[model samples]
Every structure is written in structure tokens, then in C-alpha cells.
Target: MSDSENPVDIFRGFLQVLKSFQILIILTALTGLALLVTNGMIDGDWGRLSGGWANVKIFLSESLPLDWQVIEARSYPVCEQEIEFFCSTAYIGMLETIKIAFVATVFGFIGAILLSSLAARNLSPTWLSILVRIILSALRSLPSLIWAILFVIVVGLGPLAGVLAMTFYTIGYLGKLQYEAIEGMESAPLEASRATGLSHPEIFTNVVIPQTGNHLLSQMMFMFEYNVRHGTVIGIVGAGGIGYFINNYLKLFMYSRVFSLLIIIFVVVVIIDLLSMAIRSFVNDQGDVRRPSWFTVLLPAKNAVEIHHGSAGEEES
Candidate 1:
């Protein structure tokens, strides 16, 4: 039989067509589901959506040149006013937001370190690990916004509520990340520690923690950065931050002040991102070459010495 008419070729072609049809069906189903959700639950109207776009076009046409020119002409005065506002109100709000994030992250990191150690499959009993995994998973499933709303009701609307929400969310997030890091650690060091008749805690402190210190630090920095952004969002529900002011500005239609606040937020986030990057780079570079005092604080001096000796013995053997 010709190649085109061969049974094997026909079967392969049929399978390819079946696969393509399956993918098409999946895409169609997803599109239909999205439409249904938007229409039924969200009350989305395509006509209104189009009208909104038209309104945006009109606003852009009207505001682009004349309004922009006016703002530019009075830019110096506007800048002075914004700077004063920043110094008086926005700066304090920003600082409070940072404080909330820092405190929450610290508490969360400590909790995560404890929970992750027990959650790790290689470190703890199977039952304990499964239970911790379930708890962390449940915590992680809830968004920070929901937690913030609940806390707002309980605590009566403040940064305290934000702190609690962030702390719980961070624990779940960091616990999962850290446990995976612990589980992925080199088996050799752990084996050596066990062979040396070290206790579980001793092996974990000396080998697992030191090996995964950089990963933990990186995860902490990431969580802190995320919390900073999320902290602003949680404030929208009166949990306390720059978002409270943003909501106020929106209510009053104070677009210029809102724009200024956005710029300040952008600058702050950028600075934080850069600082985190620098710190991560420093950790990666100095982590192995020389154990910094901070590193020893986590893995004590005696433990470090013992680990070094163990590694040397392993190499010799």
C-alpha cells in the first residue's frame, strides 16, 4: 500500500486529529465557562464594557493635551504641594506599612522555620508531616484579602488586623517553600551526620539549616516584598496603609493626588526590590566562602566546626 493509505499511517493521522479535536473542545469549554461566569456572577455587560471604553477614549482626548499642559505648567507648585503631603502624611503611612510588613514577616519566618522542620517528609514522622502539610495547605488556600477582611471585623479596622493576616499568610507560604528546600538538601551531609551518631535536632541544625540558609533568606526577602505590596492592598478595606488614602482620593476624584501617591509607591517598591536583590547577591557570594557571623548565629560555631570535620572525614574516606 502507498504511504498515504497505509494502515499504520492512517492510525497515526487519526490520533493526531483526535488530539487536536480534544484541545479545541477544551478551549471552547473554557471560553464558554468564562462567559458564563462573567455574565452570571460578575453581572458583566458587554454593552456597558464598550461604553466604558468609549468614555475612556473621550476622557483621553479631552484631558491629554489641555489638562496635561496645565499640570505641566504648574508642575513646580504641584511638586511642592505633593512633597509637603508626602512629608506630613504619606511618609508616615508608608513607614507604618513597612513596619507592619517587617513585623509580620519576622513572626511568620520564625513560625515557618518551626513548622517546616516538622512538615518535611525526610525530617519528621509521616503522620506529623501529613498533618502539617494539610494545615499549611489550608492556610495557603485562603487569600490575604479574605484574612484581612475577617481580621478587620474582629479587630475593628487597623494595621493590627493587617499584621495578623500577613503573619498567617506568610507562615503558610514560607513553610511550604522552606520545607521543599529542606527536602531537596544533599543526602550526603545528612547521612554523614547520622553516621556520626548525631541527634535529629543536631543534624538538622548543623547540616540541613546551613545548607538551606540561602534559600530560606531568599524566601524571606520575597515574602517581605510581597507583603509590602499586599499591605497596601489590605489597607483598602481599612486595615491601615497608603491604600486608605488612595480610597479617600478616589472618593473625592482627586486624580492628581492619586497620581502623586502612585509615583511615591512605585519609587518605594523599586528601592525595596533593589535592596533585596543586593542582599540576595551578597548572601550567595559570601554564604560558602566565609560563614558570616549571622550564618553562625543560625548554625552555631561548635556545630559549624563539627560539620566541617565531618565533611573532611567523608572526603578522606
Candidate 2:
């Protein structure tokens, strides 16, 4: 029988096609569901969406000639530093946010590592893992914003509240990520360690940590960036950060100042992302193949991927 006509060959071809299109099919289904839900929420009044552009235009008209004043020293600040910008609200607020995020991320990473070791099924008994998982879940159940509100009430408004809120949320989030990474580690090292009669703590420290170190670092960096972004939000409720100034500008309808601050935040976020990528490259296997650069990151994905492959091919050749 011809290969094309063979039933087994036909079935194999069908399976290959299904496998190739599986992701596309899933995305299409998800998109359709999202559209349906959005339509219902809007009550089919698509016409109401037409005013969005008009409102945007109005906003831009007021926010145009982006305010540079935010970077200048405030009058009360009495610019004592060599640079006036150092005394600006933007610098102070953003610095506070970074401090809060940094403290929280560091503290949270330590806490998560401890809890995740216990939660990892490969490292701990099933009962212990389940219990640890429950504790992590309870911590994660409340969003960071809610945590910020609670802390604000407890601590009476400041960066302290922001720090505590972000730390708690980070612990829960990073704990789940850490345990999953631990679980996904190769079983050979773990089995060898256990066979050698190493204790759970020793096995975890020597084997699991080294094996999953790259992933854990990546997660910690991600959590830090996440906390930085959330720092802005928590500040709105007087948790202390750039969001405090943002809230003030918003209340005063100073859209221009708000827009400027947003641009600053956007710049900082981009810088953080680039730094994260560079740092990860140092430890990731792909670092030897191709290291990332600012220009590569700014380029479109298709072009960046093509450039990466081209470089890799050249290296091999």
C-alpha cells in the first residue's frame, strides 16, 4: 500500500497536525470566551466604547507639555545636595518605593526558601508538604493591596506598612514558585543523597539548592520587580511611596504631573527588566550562547529572535 493511503500513516499525520495546532485552538477558544464575557459585561452597548478616544484626546490636551517640575527640588526641600533633582519628590518617592521593595523581597526570599523546602514533596514527607502548602496558600489568599490596607491600619501609614505588605505577599508567591522548582529537579541527585544517608536539611542545602539556584534567583528578581510596581499602588492609601504623590496629583487633577511620574515609573520598570535579564544570563545555560543587550530587548520579538539564532549559528560555524 502507498504511504499516503496507509491507515496508520494517515492517523499519524492527523496526530501531528493536531499537535501543531493545539496551542492555536486553545488560544482561539479562550479569546472567544473572553469576548463573550466582555460583551455581556458591556450589555452589548459597543457604542459606549466610541467615546474612549475622545476622552483620551481630552486627557492628552491637558497633560501635554509633560511637566518637568516633578524632577526639580521642592520649595520646602531646600535643595541642599549638589543636584537639585536629588531633593525632588520624584527621587524621594521612587527611592522610598525601591527601598520598600528591596527590603520586602530580601526578607520574603529567605522566608520562602525555608517554607518551600518543607513544602517540596521530594524533600519532605507527604503530610509535611501538604501542611506547608496549606500555610503558603493561606498567606497567598489575600492580595498585596489588602495586606497593605491592613498594615496601614496596624502601623499607621508609612513605608513600614508598604514593606510589611509586600513582604507577606512575596513570601506566599515565591514559596509556591520555589517549591514547584524544587519538585521539578532531577531525581538522580536526590536519590543519591538519600541513599548516602544524608538528612533532609543536608540534602536540601547541598542538592536541591544548587540544582534550583538559577530558578530561585529568577523568581526572587521577579518578585522584587512586582513589589516595586505594587509599591506605587499601596502608597495611594498612605502606605508611602511614589503612589502617594501620584494620588495627590490625581486628587488635584494634575494629569500632567501624573503623566510625568508614570513615565518615570515606566522607565524604571524597563531598567529593572533589562537588569533582571542581564543578571539571569550570567547564570543561565543560554548565557554562553547569547547574552542579551538593551538594543536587542528594545527590538521587536521576531527580529530579536532572528538575531539570536543568527549569532548562535555564526558561533557554531
Q: Which stretches of candidate 1 lie over 4 Å from their true place?
A: 1-86, 285-317
Question: Model 2's lDDT to the true fold?
Answer: 0.92
Question: In candidate 1, what are the lDDT values of residues 1-317, reduced to their tens digit?
Answer: 79989999999999889887997889999999989988986576667776798888865564333221212223233455443444444565677788889999999999998899999998889999999999999878888888899899999889999999999999999999999999998888888888899998887787888888878888998898888888778888988887786677668766656666666777788888787777777546654564434444678779977776676678799
Record all residue pairs in model 1 with backbone atoms less than 3 Å apart, i.e. clashing. none
**Tens digits of lDDT, candidate 2, 1-317:** 88899999999999999999999999999999999999999998999889899999999999997998999999994789999999988999999999999999999999999999999998889999999999999889999899999999999899999999989999999999999999999999999999999998899888898888889888988898899899899999999999999999999999999999989988898889888888877667874654766777999999998887887788799
Q: Model 2 segments beyond 4 Å from truth? A: 1-19, 290-317
lDDT values, one for every candidate: 0.80, 0.92
